[model samples]
Target: MSTTEKSNEKRCERDGREKVDKFRRFLAQFCATTVENLLLFDMGLCHSFPFIIIAALTGFPNKHNLNETLSLTPIEASWLASIGYISEPIGSLLSALITDALGRKVAMMVVNIPLVVAWFLMYSASSVWQIFLAIVLLGLGAGLMESPIITYVGEISEPTFRGVMIAYTHFGYSLGAILVATLNIMMPWRMVGLVCMFTPIFTTIALCFVPETPLWLLSKNKTAQAEKALCWLRGWVPKESVAEELQSLQRYSERYKSCESCIKKDQKCIHPLPTLAEKLKELKRKQTLKPFSIVMALFCISVFSTTFSMSTYIVQILKAYNIPMEPDEAAAVLSYVNNLGNISFLCLIRFTGKRYLYLTILSILFLSAAVICGYGFMVLPIGYSSFPDLSPNFPLENSNLGYIPFVCIILSSFCIFCGINSMAWQMISEVFPYKTRGTATGLTAALSYVLSFIGAKTFYSLETTLSMPGVALFNCIIIAFGLILMYKILPETENRTLEDIEMHFSDNSKKLTDRKIPKLDLSQIGSAKNNSNMPTRPVSIKGIDEQNNKKSGIGCDNRSFVADS
Candidate 1:
């Protein structure tokens, strides 16, 4: 034991500890940011790419003419515009299987393939059908990616991070819209479409380095892998705490699967793999149904908010209402404002609870849309002027009402972006128990997109028939219904653990299992056995030996314990 040798050993030990600490921090940081980035890349691009295409087409219809260039009539062009939404439900349905079977990372990868193809098709699109085909593929990618991406982010991030991670869906969407607005100004629509292809490509490459979600790994029975993944995710924590955290997730996984089973039943009887019908049945059992209903209501509100259609036809809608700015310029400004709103909401999400944020946003949107409708009603009698050549058959009576519609859209975009658009995605991830999350989320997405398809397809006709104000009024009513449903049904999930949320739904079952069972008077039984030293006598400890009193044999009935002497 030389002094020099001891000094060298101490230095080595300190260096080893430092290295371990650094690696742990690196793992934690990597897991948090990397998973979220992947989610944003997959979901945001898919969700917004179609919006970008529509933005460009709406902002510069004459330049990118389907009528002149591709021979698409008005009806055909409208159909083509909405066909992407038509295919979304199918993609959404398929995503449940993909996510459950292939894992979240792989599901995202598969969805990106279609999106890349869709972009390339848009780049080389020679006819309306080719464009339609491109959008259909885009819809597929968007549909499949939506549920899985939300689920993946929800499962990977801490509860504190889940809101922001889910909010990435909106952030990604706004970014794409901004890109479309800016790029359309800089280049041709085709080139912009080509440029969009790069996002999915780059994201796909980046995803290869990211780990799969620990929750999904646990669902697939990969306990070892799940522990490793969870450890890395919580790597900044002490090693012992990480192990405990992993154990908590495993327990949650088990309880989530068997929450519907009887409290006293043996664990083996609790069915871990429920059929779709059984899952649906479980959902109908009030406890699970409440959250499921709340999620659906939120999705419906978000989908029908008609912000998507407004974004798509921002130029036309603005021009129709006599917005003073050029349609292209107005579209770009609105897109930028909408992007800013999304960013603002993402930032605000970290500070607020989900319940308050959702209600507040929806209320603002409802009021804003109502004001727009009232203005439309008020202005109709006064005679208004709009861009003349834009819609000749629908002639404009001249007036300077342009600023009014422009301000309305700014307000509308701000409200929609700040509210339902981001909240719905975050809520979907927060509400569902992990056991049925993939299927439940997929169903919600499929239904929402179906509503979206209807809204997009009917939007032009609705505006033509009912006018912009009427459309706003229609949306206001839907928002009102959503607000009611949400207030009654939506639970506050902000900063709450997924286990806590699941437990909220399982309280009734927990009550049954947690009911106090009467304890036996073991002390009394012990005293009787010790004092009497009786082999044949049955000692009553609560009701354990009540049945033995009926036995006539020397030995007490086995239904109750017999004292041995």
Candidate 2:
């Protein structure tokens, strides 16, 4: 070949190598992010293990059944199951404060302390009260970590990958449920607690190696540290590769600070620190109010839809409905399906928009509930009852149709994990602005837990009062209502940046056209007129003064403005 031909071939070979190398870097980064997310969210196992174990203890035909071992009554078992949720609200509230004040990493580490203690307590418990106390502690730990974990994942992951990463939190919960379900069938509940307790300890150690989120670092004005953290999170890519992202984060932080300081072009001077009333007034901002309302409503819908309540009392519910399977076996199968749903969520989140996916899930859930409730009313024998006595040995007519309710329950579980659960939790981290993220997420999460508490606490009673069919009907109504509200209000957030999601809720954003204006450096603007290489434009002094007066009742001082070209 001629010299030019050889040179062209060599350049092509070099470009191919560069492309391969870039692909390798991206794959490595993705893997590292996946591992970090798994570690950060492993507490999902600890959070969910207790509920299953409690279900097994009260209802499963195990050698260490709490109903027999400790003479635990149904009421006591119900309390053990529902108490965690009630305590979670308090933990969530505390988490909001801790995550904002101490940093997300510190808040995560702090939560492990309670988790370890709660699990250890459960393992060594001899009395019902001890178990109750352990669950309360577990709830507190679960609540405390919820905000930080969601915030950390949201802050650390790229927007392109954020939906999948956030979905991993629910993945952790489903995996935990599966683990505990399998372990519950194979071993005593105490041993299950002991096995699961190690997760939080491992999480604590794993967290030591991970860096704090770059967003949180930037919020604290730790620019160099933020750069380092961002680099580390992006698989330790060279600093220049992430500089553009870092600058964007800096701009977001500055914008937040400017908003906090009440700085605008219309204002004549910078404002001082806000007073107590002024600080409270910030809560009324459109960005805060709109997202907060949407999230809180979603949480309410999720809580009342009987998703968590069913999980918490899976064994009892199955036995109540006279499903033709061992409660433990059904719980295990449901747990597996739950993970499958979460996996489907991870796979589909990239391909689907948030609003569409959510609406689809709710529709399926509503249909599933309707099927189950209809089966109960139409097919069951006339004296069938689940309340006052929940027994796995409850008799059903000998027919293949007995499996239909079980199938519907399984479908509902899948829908819950796939979309209902993930969407609500994902939005908690995505919807709020950085300044109020911890507080808003905390409050919303706390309310969610409280609603979960009510749902869980009332499941058994509702079964007693309304029967399984009635409970299903209640969920159907709530799901339908939620579906309508969500369809009307939820914005599509897939593949969108946090800034874009926040802007979607702002009235001002809707009124303003998309425009990019040059950022003026006040210090440099004064010197622009004297620079030989720079082109300057004249000031519109009267226009500036009139605009300022119209907005803030203040007039700008007479000064010549020079715009640089």
Top of the candidates by lDDT: 2
* Global lDDT scores for all candidate models: 0.64, 0.70
Given candidate 2, what's the lDDT at residue 478? 94
The numbered model that scores best in TM-score is 2
Candidate 1 lDDT over residue span 1-565, tens digit each: 9999999999888778656754554456445555445546445445545544554443346354444354444455457657878788999989987888899888887888888898899889886678789888988888988777878777776654556656656766777667777676676668877988888888777778667887778767898887666656655353464554454455445444543432223132334477777766654554455566766767678767646665555565666676777676777897778778887787887787667787887888887788777877776532222212234424235556657656867877887788677777777776666656788888888888887887778766776666666777888889888888777666666656564455455444333223121222334323333321111122112232333223311111110011111
Model 1, C-alpha of 522: deviation from truth (Å): 26
lDDT value, candidate 1, whole model: 0.64
For all predicted structures, in order, the TM-scores are: 0.78, 0.83
Residue 228 in model 2: lDDT? 87
Clashes (candidate 1): 2
How high is the lDDT of residue 371 in model 2?
93
Please give the distance, in angstroms, between residue 367's alpha carbon in candidate 1 and its true position after superposition: 2.9
Give the Cα-based TM-score of candidate 2 against the true structure: 0.83
For residue 521, model 2's alpha carbon misses the true position, in angstroms, by 21
Clashes of each: 2, 0
